[model samples]
Target chain A: MGKLISMEGNQAAAEAMRQINPDVVAAYPITPQTEVVQTFAQFVADGRVDTEFITVESEHSAMSACVGAAAAGTRVMTATSANGMALMWEILYIAASTRLPIVMALVNRALSANINIHCDHSDSMGARDAGWIQLYCENSQEVYDTLIQAVRIAEHPQVRLPVMVCYDGFIISHAVECLKLLEDKEVQEFVGEFKPVNSLLDIAHPHTFGPLDLYDFYFEHKRQQIEAYGPAKQVIVEIGKQFSALSGREYGLFEGYRLQDARLAIVLLGSAAGTAKEAVDRLRADGLPIGLLKLRAFRPFPSEELIQLLGGFEAVAVLDRAVSFGATAGPLFTEISSALFRADRRPLLVNYIYGLGGRDIDIEDIQKVGEELERTAERGKTEQLVDYVSVRE
Target chain B: MRQVLLAADTPVVVANATGCLEVATTIFPYTAWRCPFIHCAFENAASTLSGVETAYRALKKKGKISQDIRFIAFGGDGGTYDIGLQALSGACERGHRMLYVCYDNQAYMNTGIQRSSATPLGAATTTCPAGKLLPGKSQNRKDLTEIMAAHHIPYVAQTSPGRWNDLVSKTQTALRTEGPSFMNVLSPCPRGWRFPPNETIKIAQLAVDTCLWPLYEVVEGKWRLTYRPKQKLPVEEWLKTQGRFAHLFKGDNQQVIEQLQAEVDRRWEELLEKSS
Candidate 1:
């Protein structure tokens, strides 16, 4: 059994980083994500890890440095949130398309306009199409476990794509929780040594990365990258199973809580799922057949499996913390509706764009969503296809 | 350009910015690079190579890497003098063991002769056209080599491709430097400057003779002039050779020409003071 310790999400992430002890970590401090790099810096200073910690000027250079290091065939990592991630937008695509297999810890936060530094999914949600495998964690323990597994997923021979391990900004990042910690030896053994394919340092075989791809071959290269996701999904499942054996905690593409034969269900991501689970339990006591589907992996989106799971539900509500502007609904809502469009038996789906700019979504707000799902199930239709929860009318 | 790497005893890894060299060399199915090359994005060649150098250090310490390797990054003026300055400055401040080379063409030649900060004051670019209303680019060029020298890195040099011996020697010195080093090479563009393809080397040589682009190197914060023309030529000798500055010689534009010469003389005096 692993040792149990009390730590915050950022601390747990730093501890995981220390255990892995990657070759390079280039990062700049951003709100809610600062503690992770700060603690890692401490680890480097104290000689606990042999990491070349680069105190970069901006988030743009941080990601650029990681790309350079990763292409040179080393395990590289960084952390950022909100506008910091926004600053890394251009390099993010370069890192992914180059197949660098870099791992990043992304603390989800609201983007600017009102200049707030609170929890929201707008950051990572905006980067969904950048071709990174994204994993959302609910609590500190999941944060620890997912980061360790992310290294394996990203560096896998079949995957070899960058991974973003995300958690709610202040909700999970600053909140303390009791979690099990793995030993340094076990983690080192699990992560093993990274063997770079066509590393820039390889003197025998020279390779060029991120070449100019015009009309003749850009489409084919992108198609190959898209197909890599197929193998990545399988690798994620296998790595999850391996991680469960080590930690004795089960993980999958998505977790279904009290979902067997659930008539009314709500699907969401990140820490809000924990609150929705509490609302599910309270409503289950009132004899309502309701449950929650908390997504763990957002990229390589488990679309077919989600379609099968929601097919049996009488009514399902997709809760998103980020808005998609003029789209039919939020990001997750659009994907869910599209997935179910081809299903033989589809549920009455509704979207609730809640918790913008870190607005509170308490158990009460989620319970109301449960009740609305139940009502839609009874009526066999939704009064409104898109709505907002915990918002002023 | 590849000869510099070929001259080295160790393996070379190149990180190039997105510009003419990157696009024209590496097509999808074919690549002209004989060694490892990476093009991360525009404006990040220095930062990317910093990462590569950092990885080299880490792996060498871990005994995973045994062979000696050198890292070099290449960027045009747009990537080096403008958008890429922050990344380059950070890499230099951190003292990464790499060499950054800026092929200074003075304009965004790959983007159809657009005006860049490196474009000379009276040079006519597409964006800063020398029309009847405006003579040419109103602002003076940025002094990037001096800016890099301020970083106090191991080596910093300003050379032109016209002087093959000076350019080759400076490149060797930059490659041999232990810490961060920078080189600014004057690369004339035929299409952008509206000069004959055969006159590229001649224009670069004229730039050196006119004191417009002096050849100098700063080693360990001490400046040294690499080449001093026997007798400095008039600025008009260099200006008349390129069509970009031809308008400055026309009616009413003579003042612009005078202003260009004054700025160049002032910069040359300052450089001489530092070198002495």
Candidate 2:
């Protein structure tokens, strides 16, 4: 096993950064995500890591710098929250299209309208189509492990795409938790040296990044990028297995708890999955065939595996901390519903948009979801296909 | 830029903004650049170059990169003067050893003549059309050279492609500077300025002679005048050559011409004082 220590999500991410010792880290400060860069800056200042830390003016510049550095052929990383991630929208596409393997630590927070700095997946879910691989962490330990794996997954030849490691804003980012951290040498060995394929400094072989593609070729290039995601799914699984062997903690695209022959299940992302697991255990003790499936990799969504897993369940509730605005349900709900559409034996899927803007979600709230799922299974239909959980309404 | 990289005899990386230069030169399956070039986004040329330069430093320290390399960024007025100002200022203040060159074409020519902060007063653009209600752009152009100089970088210059020798020399100086450097070049856009393509250089020369675009440099906080008109021509002489400013010469818009002339004189005097 690895060394065990207590640290918050942001600090743990920074600690993982210290171990990896990236070549460049250009970041801007935003709430709930600032501690990651601030702590990493301390390491840079104390000469603990050989990193070039650039405190950029804004999140747009932060992502821009990362794109430049990565294109120049180096391992680069950054961190940001809701509005900050929104600012990086344009460059995020460029980073991925250019095939720059940049890793970003994204602390999930609600996007601004009423200006609430709380936990939500809206920030990352907004960038789902930006051609980035996204991993959602449940706690500090997962955050640390995911970041390390992100570097490996991003740099893989078949998956040279940017990656975003996301955890809850304040709930996981600020709250301390006891988590196992790999030794510095172990992380260094796992991440290894960054060998750039087409470095900007390689004068012998010149290349242009982010070229303007007209109608004649833009479609083909996009098709090639789509093909690249196929290998990315395989790479993510292989990396997860390798990480599992190293950390003694198993990981997959998603985790299943009491899922064998489950008549009812709750499918969700991030820390809320922990709460759902507790509800599952309590219901199981009362002889209810309930289960929970915690989604880890939202991007490169494990569609086939998910279809197979949910196929056996009679009723499933997909909880999302973000809304799709005008869509039938949230982003997760839409994807899950579409995935199940292809399944021969489809489950009665209900969408639950819950815990937005950092609203508290307790065991009772998840237990209520389980009870509702049971009723939906018994009734053979959902009364409300799309509903809100733990809201004033 | 190709010439500068060729002359340097070292590895060079260029970061370009999303504008005319980037789009015109780099079409998919073909590229004008012979060296490593990157175009991230429109408003982040400087910041992107800063990252490339920072990576060079890190790699050099780790013995991964043994050869010397230089970094440069190019942006248009729209990218450098307005949307990209914050990032440019940050890159300058952070002291990245890279040269940021803004080709001031006065307006967003790539987007078909929209007004930019570098569009001079009384100059017509699609956004600031010269019509009965208004003469042209109501405000004076931003002095980006002065703004860059205020950053106290090692080198800052305002040159024109019309003066080829001066432009080349200033580019060399910027490349050789130890710290951050900035160059604001007055690159005349024939389509946007509504001038004959053949008269691009002549119009740029007229701009310099009329004191509309001065040839000057600021080195380590000290300003130096590189060229001064023997006898400063009236701003009307330069304005009349471009159809964008042709509306200013109409009988009803003569007052607008006077206003532009006064603004030009004020800025010329300020430049003279700073150089002295």
Candidate 3:
């Protein structure tokens, strides 16, 4: 055991990065995620973390710099919020496709238009298909815990891929909680040092990096990238085991709260899951037969785990913070519906698009959703409910 | 261009097509063009050229490549002024230290007198055939030189094939520069221009004499004229020499000729003001 301290989620994330002892951290500061990079910058300045902290121009350049640095055989890390993540959209794909083990922390926030600077899963949801292993944290402890596991998962020899650790903006990034901080030497041994087989700017060896692919072989490259996502499951499990051994904090692709005998359940990701869990506890006390299934690992999206968890529940409300606009449903809703479609006995999946553009969703709102789900379970009904908990006349 | 190519002691790779400039400079195995040039074909030049240049730089930085090779991409106007623009922009903006030279031959003479972007306004080509209603191409040639300069590179210049020594000297200066440099030279094509093949050099000289294409250099944010025509010839004289401009001599077509002359005058005045 190292030290138990009360700290904000951003502080936990920053301290975890320091303990990991990364080689290069290229980042641009944005709201919610700003403090993560700020604290890390201070660490670099104070001789705490001896790393190349490249203060880049934009999130695009930050991600671009990460691609360059990581490709050059350096362990790289970065953090960003909504628009910052939007700006990094291009090179994020580059980092993933090139198989650079770059770790990015995304402070989930509402995307834009009548902008709200608060918590939502909008940022990470948009990046779901970017070939990155995405992990969502519920609180400050998980923020610290997941970041450690993220590095191990991303840099695994079998799965040399980029990873995005997402914790809700302001809710998890700003909210304070008790966290178990790991020792620097302990984390250093756990993550170990990164050594690249090929890198840019290496004088010892000559190699071609990032060649433009035409139609002739571009599909095969992408097909191989898709294939890596499957192996990532094993890597994530192994890293989770290692993290539990080192820090006494257990992690899984998905976690359940009273979900074993659940007839009605609310499925969600990020900080909202914490509130859903609280709602589940209250409803469970009232003998409401409700539960919460919090998705921890969203990409390489744990389909089997989801089916197994939801299979027991009668009706499931899948809450998504992103709108896939003009589609039949929300991004997460479409995913859940598709994943459960082929099952012999599937749960009645309801679509709930909530907290978009960071509108606040309280415990009451989650309770309301839970009550609705319970009613649906009782009725043995199926309905796609969207934009729930709306302010009505 | 020898001044530019020979300035660096190491091997200088040149990517060129089988155009007038390539034919003039290189002959089979008894190659005249040197700086240890690796001659690449036109269509796939940019990508492969970049591959070679990047490999060399990465190798040299790692102490793998023995000689300090200065890579230069040289091609006709058809190559640099149009087809290769995308790759050129990528290379220059990506901070490659390669000098890209466009010997503006005015037409695709290598393929048979077809029109290219570097072709002058009112010049006729197989595609831009002159007729009763229209004289030739109404639009003026695109200013590729300025476009290269806009990339915020260290060096970009507009030299004339008429001034051979100056062209060679500027070519050398660009190759020695640390970053990407682009040079566009107006090398008149005799076959395309409907002039005696021997008059190729003389007509090219006349191009500068007539201010048809002025000789200038854009260096370190300063624009300076290297050659100023003593008597700016009427656009008619340059037009009359080229069979492509034969239709321009007809009635009402003279207004189009005047419009072309006026645009030239306006540009020359702007260049003079900039030179100051």
Candidate 4:
């Protein structure tokens, strides 16, 4: 039996990484996410983890080192957030495009200007097309859970792709909660020894990576990248199931709370999902037939599962933490809307852009949004559609 | 069209990054960049290539990778000199059994002609655009040969495509070197330099004759001058041929030209002293 320990999400991610026993943990520190690397660095310092902890100068170098370390044939890991993640922007695409199974823990934080280091989804959402398999965590448990699965998903022979496990800054990153720590032996068996497909370091059968691809072959190579998506989706579910068996917790591409036998539901992802779930519980207590759909895997989005889940609901309040600027709706909202395009009886979806730029997202705010959705259904009209939920003027 | 492919007796993987070498070599699919060579294109090829070399070294240490396989970074000047310098420095300093081949085209030609430290004095690039007040660039070319040489590295060489025999020979020598070796090749950019495509080799050769670029090597702390001109040509001739330096002679900055020649002479004398 595993011992239960209360820890913050950042610690959970760092602990999960430690248990994975990566060869290199090259990372830099950033706000709301600093503790993650600090914890790992301490682990390296104390000789707790037999890994090379490359404390790089900047996020660019952190990722640069990861590329080097990973290409060198060692299982490598790193963590960063917000401005730090933005700094690693150029290399992030390379890590995925090159198919290096480098895993990164992205502590989700808001981008600056107004300057905030609180919970937000803008950072990861900005890197949506970077080609890495993006996994969003609902809470600290998933933080510990997803990280273990991320390694398996990323290192799969069929899906040699980098993965980013994102948890909202401050919200889940600093929020203390109970996390079931899996045994190191179990994780070692689960993740296994990562034998890279065409590793740079493999001298027995020397194979060159990062070749000069001219215009003629660039597009086809990119198309081949698209082919990995299907395999990646399958691997995520497989790893999820495997993880669930090892640890007594259910895992899926998505989790539906009261999704069945409910006329209306609130669709959410990341740490905000917990807040939404609380709102669902509160609404249910008052005899409201409302539920919450929590997104676990984001990259190869579970569009079919989303369509099936929403098929029964009369309407969906897509609580998106990130806005698409000039687009029709939020990033998650847009994807959900498109997923429901072929539905036999489409639910009236209301896009609610909330918790933006590290704003505090109280469960009461989610309850307020739920009330709005209920009113939208009852009056056959949607007021304040595609507006900030509980945002202070 | 001519095609060449060969498999090594041992596993040999080459990591090439995006630059002129990448663009010129890889057109892909139809003219697929694929070769008997297991070539990978990394964004910052120097670091990526270094990573490949490091990985190979670690594997070799563990008896995972074969001892015979060659690990190399087919990096461009921009990738090696500017963008990926730190990684290259780390790899070189660590003495990884890797060959860092820098196709130094003088400027960041991949992203459009911008002045890199490798760009020669008085070259008109997009960044150092020609104007009435200033004649293109005013800084001297950074002696990367000296930079790597200072690292006390086992092997470092300066080669130019102008001298193909020397370039290929330098490549061979670097490959033969037991430890980390860097080959900085003067890969002439006809497009960036605003010269006729046919003049690529001629311009490269002229660069050497004018002492703008000298062919030499720093092997195990010993300097060896590979190619020296019978008669040192005037720097003006080398400058006048390329449109990038057209503004230099057209203006009253004859002093700048003289200053450039002086620095070239100083460097040449220093190289000669070391070679002797």
Candidate 5:
């Protein structure tokens, strides 16, 4: 049994981290993501958790420390936002390729160039190819639940890779909501003691990590990293099943809301999904053949499952919170289109880039997008392949 | 590099920065190191070892690891004095029980002799060529050992490889000290400094004799000169030994050599005053 309480998303993440209680947590503060570690640091100071909390100098050091600690055979975790994640970019790949199971909480924020700190998918979307298992959450509850699940997913025997739990900055991170907290014992039993594959502390069986691969083994090592996703994709689903059993909250690669029997649909990820759910309901009530596809796992793409779920749609509008610049479509849209490229019964896909720099996406906005998607279906063609929404003229 | 290893009687876990030490020893599937080792990145060896050391303390507090082990991080001057300075500063300020040794080869020796912050004045590097308009690297080398001392760590030392006994002793003292020890050892490079391979140790010895690279330690904020020359050699003794300084012997470059010598003498006097 668990207790229900109202708390902000960052506090919820901290509570989950307290329950999980990793051996080491090396983190630096960044906006929106700051309270997550700040609360966790309080837990450490209060002796609630015995984690070796290293207040590193920068995000680069934070990730570097995580890499070193993970390779040193300790369960490690961290949290950061956009520019901080960008700072950790170089070591992010190292953590994955080295097969170190380090977990990170990424509160998504827009990247800088005029320097903004607001909800956007640009951060984690930029790291989509960094070889980490990325999990996006819709609300505070999901932020809490996904963080705990992230630990097991990262440390699974078959999947020894880093996990990034992404939630929208300020939207989900600062917004207070009622969520259930798992008993500490329950989390402890679920994650168990981390069984490391290699330990730098093992004096007898010494191992060398991150060796110079050069021409001989670099490509093969990368091939191994690629093959790792096979088991990783399975482990993610399998652990979701196990988590559902305990928590009674079912999770999947993606969640389809009123999508099964619909002809027109819109796709999105992160906190905006909650807003879209109401729009989906309004569209369904109006007798429009409209539905919603809220993606949870962005990495491993859920191509096969997405094809089966979305192939019957007449037209699908993929809403992306981040633009892909010169690309033909947004990142989420690009992935969705590529996943459906060879589908036997694919829908006409249009991309809508929206809600950048924390711009609000109201239910009416989603309803309008759904109506446009409905019109696209009625016309039997996309009016435009990619366009912006809710922006100044 | 070998002296630091020999000084540690116990087994050690090593975190190496990306430089000659890491590249020369490791080449996938084959390594010269028998101990557990990691080379994370060029600019993060200190933070990396800090992680390892923190993990050791955490696990050991729980009675998990039972080994009497030491943690060591190795970086070159490029990684230490320049690129990785922030990480090194952070690690030192945090005060982890580890030894960070900068094998001070003066420049980015592994990258075709680029001028690093540790490159001495008037020493020609590819980035600061000794051309008609230029007179080699114009800036004096950074006083990195002093910089580490400012952190007020338990141990900070400066030594060179040619002084085998002093190098080994300094390493032993550093390892024995409790928190955050640092060593900036002048690891004479034959290829980058343009000296004969056999004269590597001789070049290092000349550096110390000329007070260009002195052997000293700052233990718990108290500075001490570890080794002092019986009869101090002129700075020209060090400059003449390395081909990188060969241009100082060329026409109208005498003023640059004088400036270099004056910088060395000023630093030596400062160290002496601090020791006194």
Candidate 6:
């Protein structure tokens, strides 16, 4: 196996960056995500990485610079949080539409009108349709491991798309955890060399990026990008397998924790998945059939896999840390419900919106959800389609 | 731009902001750029090119790039003087060896004549029109040349396409400078300025001769006048040529014209003082 060590999510991300040693990194700081770039900047200064780290003034420029560097035919990476990601919304589409395989560590934080800095899924969920591969990590280990795999998944020729390696901000970001670290040479060999088909610096064989396409050809280019996502789903699975082999960690698009024969379960993303797993074990030990499916590949939503895995379960609760605002259910709940629409044995789905701006969902809270799912199963339908947890309602 | 296009002795990677230059040349599958060009976003040409230039330096230092490739960026006055100012400032402050050229058309011409920070005092634009209450843009055009020079970069200049030789020579010096360089070139937009297409060069010349747009350069920290008018004409000569300023000659706008003239004369005197 690789070397075992303890590090926080930000440093784990920095460690992954140090190992990857990309050609360029352009980043701006926001709360919760600041430590990722700061730690990486330290690596760049100490001469541990050969990356050209551009300390851009704003998140807009950060993504812009990443686009420029990635177009220049180099491996470029960056990081940002909620409002920072919101600032980068315009270029995020440009970067993905231009098909620049840039990787970023997105420390999820709540987007603001009240201006708070804490964990939430609203940030990346808002950009769900912006044509980027989104990977949600459960902890610091997953953060490091997923980031290394992200470069491979992004740069995959069939999937020349940007990837957002997202982990919970401040919670996983600042909390230290025991994880296996890969050797630098191992990561180098796995990622391989990024040989761009058309580089901006390739003077003889010139290419143009971000051209204005109106009416005639914009649809076709966008359609081609759409066609790639189907193939990208396969690439995510294949890369996960390869990563698992190298690190002795089994991985898939989503993890099934004691999900083999469970009749009631909760599906979710990020750090809450780990908490739900504990809730699953506690309920199972009490002789109740309950389990958890922690979603990892959110962009390529794994609808087909969900059909096979969660379709047979009698009832399932989707715990969302973000509200979709005006939608019938939470963002994660909507996706899960939509995925099971065509299943032969669809589960009775319920939504529990919790933990906005990082309001700590615990094991008991999740077990309570499991008990509610059992009740929903006994009732043969969801009495309440969506409910709020831990918030004063 | 034409002069620099002709004068370039080496291959250049061009970065352009969203403007007439970018939109006009690149139309999906067909591109007019013979060299590598990138246009990321409207307000980030400087930072975007900063990324490309940074990549080039990193690659060259690591011995991946052997060819001598130069970096160049082009942005409209709107991109350089307004929305893109911070990125431009940051790029210059970081000291990358790239030539950043602002095609100073003085307004958002591609979007059909909206007022930009580079739009001068008393120039009519769609956003700031010369109407009953307002007499065109009241604020002076931002002194972007001086603002850029404040970054203490290796080269900063104000030139016009009207003087082809001076424009070409200034471009050569800016490109050859070992650190960041900036050039603000007066680009006469006939459609936006409401002037005849053939009079583009003549209007640019008038701008220089009237002391409204001076031809000057700052090399390192020292200033030098590249061209000086032998007999400075009244600013009215520059304003009256364009229909955008047609309202100024009409009722009650002569005082506004005088204000424009006084401001131009003050800036010109300051330039002369600095150069000497």
RMSD of each: 1.0, 1.1, 7.9, 4.2, 0.8, 1.0
Whole-model lDDT for model 4 versus the true structure?
A: 0.79
The TM-score of the first chain in every model comes to 0.99, 0.99, 0.97, 0.96, 0.99, 0.99
Query: Per-residue lDDT for A160-207 in model 4, tens only?
Result: 999999998888999899978888888888889878666554444444
Writing each residue's lDDT as its tens digit, candidate 2 over A1-393 gives 567899888999999999999999999999999899889999999999999998899999999999888888889999999999999999899888888899999999999998999999999999999999999999999999999999999999989999999999999999999999888999999999998888877878888888899999999988998888888889999999999999888887889999987888899999998888889999998888998999998889889989888886799999999998989999999999999899888899898899899999999988888888888999998889898887886
Clash number for each model: 0, 0, 4, 23, 0, 0
lDDT, residue B271, candidate 3? 81
For residues B165-252, what per-residue lDDT tens digits would candidate 3 score against the true structure?
8787787778778887888877776677788777777777777777778888877777888888889987776777767777778777
| Candidate achieving higher DockQ, 3 or 5 | 5
Residue A290 lDDT (model 3):
80
List residue ranges in candidate 4 displaced over 4 A.
A42-57, A64-74, A201-224, B1-12, B30-43, B57-63, B66-70, B86-97, B109-115, B125-134, B146-181, B189-210, B214-234, B240-253, B265-276
Q: What docking grade does candidate 2 earn?
A: high
lDDT to native, each model = 0.93, 0.91, 0.76, 0.79, 0.91, 0.92
**Deviation (Å) of B97 in candidate 2:** 0.7
Off by over 4 Å in 5: none
* Candidate 5 residue-wise lDDT, B1-276, digit = tens: 788989998899999999988998989889988899999999999999888888988898889988789999999999999989999999999989899999998899898999999999998999998999898999998999999999999999999888899989999998998898999988888889998899988889989999999899999999999899988898899899889999999999999989988888899999999999
Per-residue lDDT over B64-163 for candidate 6, one digit per residue giving the tens place of the 0 to 100 score? 9999988899999999999999999988988888999999999999999999999999999999998899999999889999999889998999999889
Candidate 6 residue runs with Cα over 4 Å from true position: none
Q: DockQ for every model, please.
A: 0.87, 0.87, 0.08, 0.30, 0.83, 0.85
Tens digits of per-residue lDDT for model 1, A310-368: 88678999999999878999999999889888888989999999888889999989899
How would you encode candidate 6's per-residue C-alpha lDDT over A65-141 as one tens digit per residue?
89989999899999999999999999999999999999999999999977889999899999999999999999999
Which 10 consecutive positions of candidate 6 chain B have the poorest summed lDDT?
B1-10
Candidate 1 shows a clash count of 0
TM-scores computed on chain B for all candidates: 0.98, 0.97, 0.88, 0.89, 0.98, 0.99
lDDT of 3 at A155: 86
lDDT of 2 by residue, B10-125 (tens): 56788999999999989989999988899888899999999999999999999888888888899999999999999999999999999898999999999999999999988999
DockQ for candidate 1: 0.87
